[model samples]
Target: RAPEEPLHLVLPSDRRLLRIAHAVLEHPDDVRTLEEWADWAGLSPRTVTRLFRYETGSSFAQWRQQARLARALERLASGEAVASVADALGYASVSAFVAMFRRSFGLSPGRYFDTQAVIA
Candidate 1:
């Protein structure tokens, strides 16, 4: 079976949820927890988690990772080195970043352009 796609591509059905998501996007690398997001959105943590799944079809943590990955892709595409990108994105280490990137895209950041070239 094909891997399930990331849910950031899916729009949130609730306007309030969308606003919360936008706030999260403003600082995707800040390492904030769901509780923090809930406070920022003026909702309870449980409600925030439920709303994320209901409106965005992903858990809050999953959505955050997707947001961070999206930013990572942009930085990497602009010629940032993998280790530096990892640090800038608040990853514990470069290996962790590579692992997450591989899981998300099925290719390490180092090989992403190579794979694109082959596909083209």
Candidate 2:
């Protein structure tokens, strides 16, 4: 088995945070739990949260929200309806998603996408 292939290891906390951040970006709409990310990182959820927050200055949930909105922006900019984007991002209702989005971006998703369209 070629010496069983040495286990990949990363020790620097920043490197670990970057890996977790990338995972959030790639799986933005998945609503991954902290336990899921902890398992993937081979660390406890508390450790992941601490290091991620220290390195990124945000909790995993907060960072994940940013990631989801980034993806949502792209989808909306591509002309997908807010309803479909909300559903795809694991939101139970368009209104709920819009409320969260407005909290983050100061405008509703429809208006955000309209701005993008105008800018383009």
* Best candidate, lDDT: 1
Residue 108 shift from truth in candidate 1, angstroms: 1.3
lDDT of 1 by residue, 33-94 (tens): 88876787788999988988987778888888888888887888788889988998888889
Q: Estimate the TM-score of every prediction.
A: 0.82, 0.75
lDDT by residue (1-82, candidate 2, tens digit) is 2222121222235766677777666666666689887888788999988887776666777767767777787788788989
Against the correct fold, how does model 1 do in TM-score? 0.82
Give the lowest summed-lDDT range of ten residues in model 1: 1-10
The CA lDDT at 116 in model 1 is 63
